[model samples]
Target: MCSRDLKTPWIDLNTLMRGQRRVLLRHGERPYQLSITRRGRLILTAADQDTDTAAAAAPPGKARS
Candidate 1:
């Protein structure tokens, strides 16, 4: 016989961020950056800080398809 009743700890999203810009930083030979805007939009910036990687990676010409 086996039991499946288990309790997990709760994690708060705000607590994780702690009121700061949350950016995903890739570290390696070819590093990159990604983040969620205050308006709740996904953003990607290159090292040059002029190109939007997310926009470029987006499906041809669709918001999210």
Candidate 2:
């Protein structure tokens, strides 16, 4: 769905975040959240209120993991 030709598998944080603290991604009936941590790290997880929060770490050197 990306329009620009990507030389490498990389995306600008500013562009992706779009100045928001969190972004929601919908898949069928489930919604996932992409958020910025207090330490300026990135986290992606299921957005269900009752579900446990599991965040995958950002790539090495991208943030303090």
Candidate 3:
């Protein structure tokens, strides 16, 4: 299993990735992508790959009042 040091402010991407192709992050209903580049750089992006599905699955109560 992967472990993280909560007391530290940094995240070890290598450990986080764990040989995975990509990592998906979900905030409420929105999804984000984290990936690595060929040049050994980290990339973060808003994963809009499934906008329709996300919108359909989103809870209505999460909307602004």
**Candidate 3, which ten residues in sequence have the lowest lDDT sum?**
56-65
lDDT by residue (1-65, candidate 2, tens digit) is 65876765887988976776666666898888787877998878776643332222333224322
Clashes of each: 0, 0, 0
Model 3 scores a C-alpha lDDT of 0.59
Per-residue alpha-carbon lDDT of candidate 1 for residues 1-65, written as tens digits (9 for 90 to 100)? 25554675566656644454443345564445454565766566554334344543443224522
- Per-residue lDDT tens digits for candidate 3, residues 1-65, read 26776876776777877665466677888787666666667677686756443342333223312
Better of 1 and 3 by TM-score: 3
Off by over 4 Å in 3: 1-8, 49-65
lDDT agreement of model 1 with the native: 0.48
Residue 28 lDDT, candidate 1, scale 0-100: 68
Model-by-model lDDT, in order?
Answer: 0.48, 0.63, 0.59
Runs in model 1 with CA error above 4 Å?
Answer: 1-20, 48-65
Candidate with top lDDT is 2
